[model samples]
Target: MASRFVDTHRDISYTKDVVRLHSHAFYELLYCCSGNLQYLLGVDRYQLRRGDVVIIPPGISHRPLFLEQLAEPYERYVLWFSQEFLDQVQVFCSDLDFRGGYRLLRTAGTPWESLGNLFAQGCREAERGAPGWQGHVCGNTMQLLVELHRACGKGEMPAPMVEQHELLDDLVQYVEVHLAEKITLEDTARRFLVSQSTISQTFRQKMGISFYRFVTQRRLIAAKTEILAGRQLETLYETVGFSDYSTFYRAFRREYGISPSQYRKLQQTQTIPPEA
Candidate 1:
């Protein structure tokens, strides 16, 4: 398997207006530098305070909720790496649950300093752009995982609990069935006979994402599948419930790092493997 790494430091101000529930094919480690942030995983919301580190695995839907418009910048360090990186480290530690789902960690003592230094070093190596920097970053990333596991052993942080609710399941199914239609939080709340706050609270508490984000993400996923299946991009925006092409274009690019047309071309050129 191949390995890759990408790291960035963002001093973000203003709110992320759209609720874009998205995921990647790789793991993400988010280290909050400062400010209060709400981290959404699935439908559950975790209040991320400064120095909090969240470990998110591949295929797990999540997003950072910048609900309130900030007076000052909200700083964070985000690192993404391929699954192979975690696999290589797993051979040495059998108890670590790197691939299970996601982890919310708070550093303690030695592991705290260790994880911080490793992340800082990884960022530096990434910025330096020297020869063999990839190797250096990978090594540090592995260590960061190890330090994270060590902290877990010491009970530095408690694992976030995920509870099941029957209403949430129905809500998800309802959204999926009505993907092509215009829906709002107020409408959903009214249909379910719950208040807007109840809908938002339950979604954030159980699914780790906002109701709005979940709907948009589902629509985008449908849009991508239709695009890859040879559907015309110009016709998809309206069908996907996006009112305008520009808004759809921006959201699509933000989620996939490419325009719908570019994504279509890339998918078309790739060789699909035979099924077993």
Candidate 2:
């Protein structure tokens, strides 16, 4: 019942090279249908492969790293939701051990498999706008939570994700708190009391990408949010900390498969003007 007259597609393909990361103000769920990814969570890093489901809460910064030399493309079905969408279920299972915290749903067990299927079906139904598709998706989301709880209760919990390098946690926090400011690997490394090499190496190992790449990826994600929120690119680019137009254009085009100007052109709607 909560359809934005303009619903963005949940399926996405990421093939170009990108180095930015992003966090939402609302909850988002990602199911990796194929390929591998390394995700940066709050103070931790996770190496996610096929069959792994990642849940990113509002304000949690995350980045997707490049695939290995022998790896394939990274494609996934993602569902985005606001807090109000799932609050109704809180009353039904407040006492569950995994109640309020986010989790990574594995593809190994029966429960996770069910959740995957339900998610796939819900996306299909939502796209089709079947008789009660919105409600169906909302319902499937609740069921997925239930299955997650059952899996946790039965003691099939995956290890609590930990950043590969302990200091990488502090680094992520620093970058976000300073998202709009000028940031560089050397400056951050000095501030954190670590050598540039250590900082670069540790960040890459812990976050599955280099420090510079992570910052860029975060900026790109910020740009997308600004586009969705209907902001002008000239201001948004600076707001997200890009140094120059050429770099921003290259990063935006590479990350999203289209130039920023083109993206604005495609999303042009009279209701909200994306350009200043």
Candidate 3:
């Protein structure tokens, strides 16, 4: 979260017992107002209860993996922004890792957590003051830098932790761009003129998962994001490479902790739908 490069405050949505969604492009911060929920982050999945928060970073595909039966994917607020907005703040966080990721940084005083709360609180405070709504969001965004400084500590930022610099990022970026088309490792590796083993090995080395798994997770996430965005089920499913209806449904549920149809229905009644 202390990187000095370009990033965006990607999303800050309030869930009202509706569909819990995740995306591939940006980092996500889930601040639970109440209830319990499980999230699939990267290859390792985890859960969070009340007052619990989680961070999902770029390149790592994540989605809701579980939720309490009584909570209807509601009562949660999210602040999703890029880690790059803190170019100045990066200078202060010498102890943080520069390469960037969704590391579980102590949850409370960590750079991710503090900035998350600051952003979420700012978003809420902005709604209280109507005249400067836009400015309030903007100002709060700027304040996110200071929050990072406090959470990351004055220690020397850790070295970039990313292992594979090429394949993993390339593959994830490919998935994001080709979410609407059928994608396969053979075709993907062919585009890069590398062997399947190379693709698989490189992907696992950096992402800690197989290329195929990453692709499936990415596609399911794309379909989920599209559903949250109000796209038709069949259309989005096919667009993201699900060839069969039943398979799509099962895979979506396995990854998201809920059915696609249910998510779409909940989104319709909620506030602004999800955006990737």
Best by lDDT: 1
Q: Roughly what TM-score does model 2 have, to 2 decimal places?
A: 0.61
Query: In candidate 1, what are the lDDT values of residues 115-148, reduced to their tens digit?
Result: 6667778888878979998888887877787788
TM, every model: 0.63, 0.61, 0.44
- Model 3 per-residue lDDT at 217: 70
RMSD of each: 7.6, 6.8, 11.8
Candidate 3, which segments miss by more than 4 Å at Cα?
1-22, 71-74, 82-84, 87-99, 105-120, 152-275
lDDT of 2 by residue, 58-144 (tens): 546665655442167776767666555556677787753332556676765544565667668767877798787767777777777
> What's the CA RMSD of model 3 in angstroms?
11.8
Candidate maximizing TM-score: 1
What order do you get sorting by lDDT, best first? Answer: 1, 2, 3
In model 3, how large is the Cα lDDT of residue 57?
A: 61
Residue 53 displacement (Å), model 2: 1.9
Against the reference, the lDDT scores of all candidates come to 0.68, 0.65, 0.55
Q: Give candidate 2 regions above 4 Å deviation.
A: 1-14, 17-19, 67-70, 94-99, 109-111, 160-163, 166-170, 173-187, 191-276
* Range of the 10 consecutive residues with the lowest summed lDDT in candidate 1: 267-276
